[model samples]
Target: MNVRQDIHSAGVPVLCQSCEARHRGLCGALEPDQLVELSKTASRHGVSPGAELMGDAEVVERYSNVLSGVVKLTKSLSDGRQQIVGLQFAPDFLGRPFKSESAINAEAATEVSLCSFPRTVIERMMRVSPGFEHRLLKQALNDLDEARDWMVALGRKTASERVASFLLMIARNIEPASDPAARSASFDLPLTRADIADFLGLTIETVSRQLTRLRTDDVIRIESNRHVTVDSLSRLQQRCGD
Candidate 1:
């Protein structure tokens, strides 16, 4: 009758039967039997905000799926300056494949839930499962496309537009299945103002000023500094300079 019921009827492992990743992420490519086999070594865990899930050049031991909450991907300069390169949301895969060490640092931006499996298990599956490999490729390509779009925003967009675009990106990704016609959305910001400023290549003051402008214009509402409610997604999109 519903998605949960359908998953139950499919007889997948209990751990995966209700997982969003099982339906929309790489696990979607696996058969029920495969899921059962994979679940033998899979583990679910919670990570608090500010926790480092993986570090730059860290030895790869496991791969994970973001079951809930946000993860930030960052790159550091030799001088110790770090840039927020990307954000990962629920159902997104959380590691690099075929690499012995990670190239970027991944940190939890909010209270996060993850389902992790040993690196060898996933790599072995990829070698044997064409569907699994294809799903991974598709995600990689999608990330590349998003990175390119963000490059344009950072390189050419004004401070105001960049802020709007960043907010729009978070709203869209945080709830990928949100109804398009609803034209409204609300969610807590996954990153702090400083992190947002770094991601958008703007000063913290500029980010706050633009956010205040958006609030004054009725494009969005901010509560308690982190929660954001976009009153009109269309109006917000209009400000993005897309």
Candidate 2:
């Protein structure tokens, strides 16, 4: 069955990053019984491409971590102009940690796999588990750094620089560090041109133009419409003004 139906069914014991949990999720600091108890109140959900997990202004009751695929955090103007503020990738956490609702909405950019537990339950556990609390704090700090980085990109970076930086960020996510291969570094790109445009504060056409420029300059090459290969790290970092 698909992810949607699978949540309602009992899953077998999964051996992953943690025998108790994987990917720095709540299971990392909890015992098996603790995980099982939380899972009891928890739910698993799959979202189809473009399906919203939480819309803007809606209070969220659960927290999630991506098991597979991607999701995007976005916001829109009352007039309907939208900006993508964050990209969620596999092994990454999703949803607001300390808040109930956000001004932004989160939606699946592709078919998504998620493990969701009730916020109340998780928060309760945090009060008793210092390790769990520290993990959450670290996650928040990481997100803060990413947000600051975006301010630099949106406020100062040019269109070409924005696209180049975007590619570099995706590559970093897929492989913990940058490693070149076969004259071009390649990795799956989870966002579309429009999403990149939103994140970079540019229109779709501008995003396309920058991508073309990067390709022509041999900074990056698009192996597929959705997959990118970077040819030079120095040039890519130079584009970021780093």
Candidate 3:
């Protein structure tokens, strides 16, 4: 898993003010000097689609804040059945602090960029910085809340509703440097039909039918099998019954 060396920027210390994740992620909790210290150990990485970022039970040596694209958190059973437990978006932190091994497998759902640093550095910082600790705690709670909501969607919602709900979630979350003023948006499906099926707890055929149904009803426009364009956010939300 040797990445291109060019992708690794020399850890020249930098300020937090210009970081994209400064206000939204872990960097938001850091003071000026602390930010510089973090920069010294942090490097940027570009991950290709389908690459395994971390594996279940693997030692956690480093942590990353996702800069762009989607990551799927998966869990496998003893029988080899796999489930997509969760999805992480840009500016979301990855890795478990204070834990030696990962609980789930994290794979890149699309081409992704990350700001990564050693786990020990983050752990040490958390011990001394209450703000950092609070931010991590808040992030954990938010993830828990989202997990609970997904549990309801999977357990109570119909197949079609589940598909619509997934689409709506992506539409709201996936932003790719688009015009902030634009109400309409378009992005490629980061996960394949099979992957989506695993995530939604449906068969591939069921997932295909639901997507076609959405397109036929004019809720969305599809180009290549992977590309999706939503005409209106409100219309998509309405179809999701949200």
Going through the candidates in the order shown, the clash numbers are: 0, 0, 0
Q: Rank the candidates by lDDT, best first.
A: 1, 3, 2
Highest TM-score scorer: 1
lDDT (Cα atoms) of all candidates against the true structure: 0.91, 0.71, 0.84
lDDT of 2 at 56: 89
Off by over 4 Å in 1: 1-9, 175-182
Worst 10 residues of 1 by lDDT: 1-10
Root-mean-square deviation of Cα positions for candidate 2 versus the true structure, in angstroms: 5.2
Candidate 2 achieves a global lDDT of 0.71
lDDT of 2 by residue, 1-242 (tens): 23233232233223332322353454676654455556566666688998988788888788877776768888889998787888877666676767878677899888887888788987887887787777777877888999998898888877777777887777765443333343346677777777777778889999888888887887877776777777666678788764
**Candidate 3 on 156-235: residue-level lDDT in tens?**
88888899889877876776623445567688988999999999999999999999999999989999898899888777
Task: Give the C-alpha miss distance for residue 99 in model 2, angstroms.
Answer: 3.3
Clashing pairs in 2: none
Across 183-203, the per-residue lDDT of candidate 1 in tens digits comes to 788999989999999999989
- Give candidate 2's error at residue 5 in angstroms: 22
Candidate 3 lDDT at 154 equals: 91
